[model samples]
Target: MSYKPAHAGSGPASNSLRILETVARFGTGTTAKEITDALRMPPATAYRLLNALVGDEYLVRTSDLRGFALGHALSGLVAAATPPTVCTAARTIIDEFRQGVRFAVHLMMFRSASLRVAEEDPDYPLHSVFELLRYPHASAAGKLMLAELGDPALALPGGQLVKVTDHTITDSGRLEEQLAEIRVAGQASEINELEEGSASLALPVQLPDGSAGAALCLTGPAERFTAISEHAEAARELTVRLKPLLF
Candidate 1:
């Protein structure tokens, strides 16, 4: 069961990382014996590294405790390292839309259990109130994410539908209804919901896997986006521009 290193001259740390990478590539799970066979390491060395990784929470033992899978920490590391390509494409589109529409634009991604502003128009920055990652029920972008996530997402801790303004939807039941409507309409909108005199229109960015990846939004004075036709046109244009980049 003992063997030499698959990659000669590699240090213990490098070997440890390779072990992790190998386990991830398996997707289902991997046994210590399997790892030893793949890496050509001694069975004792492979078992030792696997035990250490499981101890540190970088890898987790399967239900039977005979195989290893990625732990929460490793999953988080992967998510942090892999920035969604849609965010980059959305940023470019937001910048261009900002120039043409003369409105503040934002690209929001749902990450780490929060709606994060991944990118915003530099020249026309978002107002201070809309800067932080909060108010899911009040902002068009946040509402869009909630709609995509569905009921299970609402059950998460700290996911209360807080009222940010008089217009904000506070009741869970009502909010669910609105989310359903947004899902059907294929767009979301907010008029003075996050802040008085501010309005926003957000359309979902479809990921390659067909899930909602992010929301591309335009925000400005309420008067500017008051017309339903304007929102429809903007959503249509954004979807058309984002199609090639996304798929």
Candidate 2:
């Protein structure tokens, strides 16, 4: 994920903006389940919303039968919508987390209705998976962001669960259960779901309205991250300390 601010070329997004944006961002067709995993909406809600978008011609169905992309008419709308400002507000906190964690750190905004990486540090030498946000249930950041939706502590797009990895949580019932736990715990963790032998810790960035506007994460190899319990503890502390900056 590259850290960048919203530009003038961006446009305003509506409630249904995610459906089109997800397709454009991911650059591939997506299923309702994938949308739900990335956006954190209930399965039924995601299905209904995506269906509506398709019906309205804001999204187009793909040949695979379970994927969608921006409809012909909606492409220009995304280019005009502003990327989002949450990144600007939280960049300091995100950078701090990276410095302390000594690993790649990324911040993802709940944009258009999906999790979009708003920033990533170049010093870490890891590519930000902001692109994967388009592929629901593809990464730890996506799952954490989706989990935050139960509390709307993280703004999320609505869609069904999509499976990206063998370890990825594709079962809606189980994924919901995991999200409930994350909401109560104030954070979430994942191993090898996004990438094999990789682990991560994440927490939601809440807005003044108590909505989760984005998520902050620390990621690295499984060995380095798993051995450092202190890192997890510190990340937890950072999330709590930064709560004021977000909410």
Candidate 3:
């Protein structure tokens, strides 16, 4: 995990970045000599750039050992580069929901006990509340995603839950009880847990095998998202209407 010096030259560094970008776009490794030939740089300069990239963990030595390829450090960046399958399919539903509610609509994916907001509507207000975008099991969407891990019926993985907000449920005992409620209701709700005066309603997006792939959420001011409020009802209705697209 060696790091480059802070005062590296920008001109040559920019060229190296261009080389990495080309390799990534091509989806394969390129030999240092090949890169030099392509970019019209000297062989020694190309080798220096390649080793620099390798040390940064953005590239790995290929099987040939003479070439370099993208590494796992680029995996998270790539995953975030494209919208997930569920989000791509549910875009219409999400857009309409955001338009109708005039509030933020977030699509969250479950990674262990945490919920990561993979997609959000830019036009939707209250953007700062979701600025961090990723959080532990606290919001309605987070809880809905967490509930997937407890379903004996779904046979998903289980692990120690991580708490992100003051209102987060850390105890396994209480979490299991709450998950049961999510299983029965097919949805979850949270009020002022992640942020004071903010609330949300969320329902699991079940895949073809009946396993939860993600959660669909609508977030807004607490006063606007009551238990039996029209906003909540509309979000629930949107979730139901979007069900067919998940497959």
Candidate 4:
């Protein structure tokens, strides 16, 4: 993990920023020792900065307390940031998929547990991504990321869900039930939920550690989609193809 920090040899502020960058790049389970080596910092300096970051809520220790992940305190920064640019290789794959399907294919990604679109199908416009992010329950890609969390309720508003359509899952209980099913199925769907005649199907894009941090979704008129199995086959292949490039 050793590398020179981009903003090193300056002072506490530069040191702190480097520490945060390292933790973010490594994702969850990044330890103090790793940060120290990666940033080439003294043990004392790294520990001091880590403690301050944790106290400020910019970083959180994993449940095991041996590693760290970005914390909710930085949600605002994540919310404002655009999706990471799709690399040439990944873009080529997504373009090929879009050529084969009339339906809209979205490369939905997450950062700090918030949804971002890496690429949206150009042929068919995605109605309102803002609304989908605003109400996760109304979007399959949204629900897919929510299902990956240790507790779905953390991201959900809880109690009564705001109904986006007649088919939207309004009851919190039913939402939980559906999330459970999504976990078992490794897929999520919105059947006339987000809007009348609009449906979406999502298959998770697995991270190296095997947790789903991104989704490969096809969205369009419900009639445009057939059985879930039909969409799942191609999506599963895309997930496999994307794993190395995406992570």
State which candidate has the highest lDDT: 4
Question: What would the TM-scores of all predictions be?
Answer: 0.64, 0.57, 0.55, 0.69
Q: Which is better, 1 or 2, measured by TM-score?
A: 1
Q: Candidates 2 and 4: which is better by TM-score?
A: 4
- The reply for model 3, stretches above 4 Å from the true place, is 1-89, 111-114, 125-134, 151-165, 227-229, 244-246
Which of candidates 1 and 3 is the stronger one according to TM-score?
A: 1
Ranking by TM-score: 4, 1, 2, 3
Deviation (Å) of 9 in candidate 3 = 24
Once fitted onto the true fold, the runs of candidate 1 whose alpha carbons sit more than 4 angstroms away are 1-58, 61-69, 76-93, 128-132, 152-157, 227-231, 243-247
Pairs of residues at least 3 apart in sequence or in different chains that clash in candidate 1: none
Best-matching candidate per TM-score: 4
Candidate 2's C-alpha runs over 4 A off are 1-81, 86-93, 125-131, 151-160, 240-247
lDDT per residue, candidate 4, 1-247, as tens digits?
4455546466888898888899989999999998888877778878999999999988999999999999877665766485567789998998898787777888888766667878878887788767687677889988998898846655556533778888888877888899999999999998888878888899998999999978888887887668543767887899899989999
Locate the minimum summed-lDDT window of 10 residues in model 3: 151-160
1 or 4, which is superior by lDDT? 4
* Model 1 lowest lDDT segment of ten: 152-161
The Cα error of candidate 3 at residue 135, in Å, is: 3.4
Candidate 4 lDDT at 193 equals 85
Q: How would you encode candidate 3's per-residue C-alpha lDDT over 1-247 as one tens digit per residue? A: 2334233554776877777876776667677766665666666666787788789888899887867789776665666555556646578768766766655788776544344566666765434344234543556776776677664223222444445556656676876788788889888887766776777777777767777767777777888775424566676676666668755
- Full-model lDDT, candidate 1: 0.75
**TM-score between candidate 4 and the true structure:** 0.69
- The residue pairs that clash in candidate 4, if any, are none
